[model samples]
Target: MATIKDIAKQAGVSISTVSYALNGSPKVTPETTERILAIAKELNYIPNAAARSLKTRETKIIGIFLTDFSGAFYGDLLQGTKETLTRKGYELIVCSGKQSHWMLPERMIDGAIILDVTFDSEDLIRYADRGHKLVVLDRELAHPNINQVLLDNKAGATLATEYLIEEGHREIYAVTGPGSSYDSKQRLQAVMQVVERTAGVQLHVIEGDFNKEGGELAAKAIMAGRRDGQAAAAVFCFNDEMAIGMMNYIAEHHSDIQVGEHIHIIGFDNMELASYSQPRLSTIDYSKRKWGALAAEQLVKLINSDAVENERIYVTLLKGKSVGTSK
Candidate 1:
């Protein structure tokens, strides 16, 4: 509600004098600066950030775009991004949906870290052409203004499949994520590759939506295909949520079916709930916090005009009781 003119009128000084004092200009005496600051505090004056940004062309704020805030998977990732940005004198804001996409093109944020599947690569390239800096976690885009921090999905998938193979599961069920998912596609490719090379291995692919419901549906289908109390089979759910869903479904409805005995299972992502299950879920493990931190670090470096190389987060096989030697 208060303006520089009001402060100038109250202080009996010119508008230019008020401006200089408010901005801590050396042209104004320290006594005048202190007096103006005191009046500003009393009047609850807030600086016009929009006008300031126009002059400096920097907001010192970064945005993280997500598809949606769901599940237990995003906690450490977000924490890593926030902590890294905060330590570097930048603030982070999480955004979702198509409406928030304008923040990047409009220069509301200095840079962005993208993990949203809805964001198109063509649109991102257009933004990069306009000199916007970005770090992508979901897909690859080759641009000087854009850098990638992707997971080694191929390696993780291979590890998951190889673990099932090592457990002597010849008839393996592979539950996959959405068709549009880059990670899902990459993992599926790896699974197929491993299945092709391993002797006498067969992979039955089940389409999944990267959710618990998908896993439940896949479990139902698998159960229907097999006879009751038959030999054990190995399943590789593309993500931990689906694996948990399948486990929960079997627990409630098919007590005759035993996990780690009649139906050995493994999943990707190594989500926290993986360990909490009755038979701890074997999964592909990677550092989610490190993934997020690297993305933020790359975005900041890109913003500062520093050369940034695309980075990859490696994966490992985490063995758990949910997987066992098949009969």
Candidate 2:
């Protein structure tokens, strides 16, 4: 029921002054801005997103696009974005691109944080073509207009495998993600690189959906003894979900498989549950939430700013009991 004019009158300021102060225009003095804000708050003023967008060309909303909205894999990542955005006073709008799901046009978003969209180069091209502020995470596509938050997949993958090797594990097995996943290639590449550089060490490889069931099946087949000599001395899973599933299988069926003594397992993504798994899981602890926040932050900067800012973030490893002596 209260209008900007009413607030302006009540604050003893002109309508233009109230408008400039509320919109955060630099022309408004700090003292006047504080007074206007205090009055606005006392009146419980609600900003008109639609009306304000028309004047400033901003909705103050960031779009988060994902392929599928399932599992802790993404949940962990959202954790970072949510916390970071909240602190910065930006709101997030999440949309999934499946089937009839079209991309959220620029009208709904001032900027976007993209993750794991099924469409490849062309979609990214079209996305970039729109000339909207965009930040892509977990995918490798380069463009002058697109800001990417990427990781050293090969390096992180190699670190997990090499850590297992240093722990005296001989035979290592790996479970990869969907073929379309860029991370799948990078992580698997790390495993093979270690295999090629070493002699007499066997690497058992399998592919899965980056889910728990996939890891369980990969574990069963790899441990079934089809490769040279013994079963996998250790398994390095692509994600923590798969690693947890593999551990569950070992607990229910292969009780004799004590981690460290029998077989050690390492996983990537260092999910919240990784440390809680039976013997616990050793994993790469990259901040998915940080990535989310960073992605959102970058997109916002691109949107509000006149220039583009792009950079890559490094992921670190979190040692756990499963890797032996790590906590």
Candidate 3:
């Protein structure tokens, strides 16, 4: 509720003198600076960050935008981003939804790392054209002001599908995330490519929402189709959450169809819960923390006008009891 004007009036000094003293300008004498500080403390004056940023053009704050904050998948990633930003002398703010998009254009944050599909690629490019620095985690944009630090979704999908095929599965199903998701699109493209070229692999595709519920739905569909005498099925759920859901469905309803024996499963994003599932989930593993850290790092470099190339977080196949050879 206090302003520099009030401090200046109380100290019997000009407003400009108060401003200089508060900002530690050498033009103001130490006696005047100390006097102004004492008055400011008495008034409990808090400097306006928005006004300060207007003058300096650097907020020293970075924003990370996500679609939502409900999943375990984002925990390690956000922690990594926060740690890296703090190390770089910047602060991190997590944002979501359309309302928060204004922060980037309004200069509320010095830079942004975008992982939200709700954000239009065109809008991001427009922001880049206007000299806003960005690091994209979910989509591709070819602007000098923007950098890409995306996951190797295609490679992970290929690895998961290939692993299923190697385990001797002929009836393979691929459960995908929302159609709007860039990660889902990339992973599906790779899964389909691998299935198409492989001999005698019957590929079934199911639309999923990258949630546990979506996995449960896919499991229902798989069971409904199994009445046609399909002995064993290998399913590649786009993410571990969905895989866990499907496993839960099978364990609860189809008690006879044991995971790892009758229903081999593989998933992307080796989430923490994947290992603790009834039978450990076989999955494509990548460090979400490292992905987030790289995105934050690249965003800082972009903001500094340093040269940065596009970055990709690689993946590995983690074997688990949930995936076994089809007999």
Which one wins on TM-score? 1
TM-scores of all predicted structures: 0.93, 0.80, 0.92
lDDT of 1 by residue, 1-327 (tens): 998888888888998898888777999999988998898889988877777678779888999999889877899999999989999989999999999999999999999999999999999999999999999999999999999999999999999998888888899999999998999999999999999999899889999988999999999999989986566889999999999999999998899888988899898999998989888989999989999889999999999999889999999999988444644
Worst 10 residues of 2 by lDDT: 98-107
Question: Which residues of candidate 3, in runs, are more than 4 Å off?
Answer: 8-39, 322-324
Number of the top-ranking candidate, with lDDT as the measure: 3
lDDT of each: 0.91, 0.76, 0.92
Worst 10 residues of 3 by lDDT: 318-327
1 versus 3: better TM-score goes to? 1
RMSD per model, one decimal: 2.1, 4.5, 2.2
Give the residue spans of candidate 1 off by over 4 A.
Answer: 8-35, 322-324
- Would you give me the overall lDDT of model 3? 0.92
Query: Which digits, one per residue and each the tens of the lDDT, describe model 3 over residues 1-327?
Result: 999999999999999999999989999999999999999999999999999999999999999999998767999999999999999999999999999999999999999999999999999999999999999999989999999998999999999988888888888899999999999999999988998899888898999999999999999999888864556789999999999999999999998888988889898999999989878889999999999999999999998888999999999999997444655
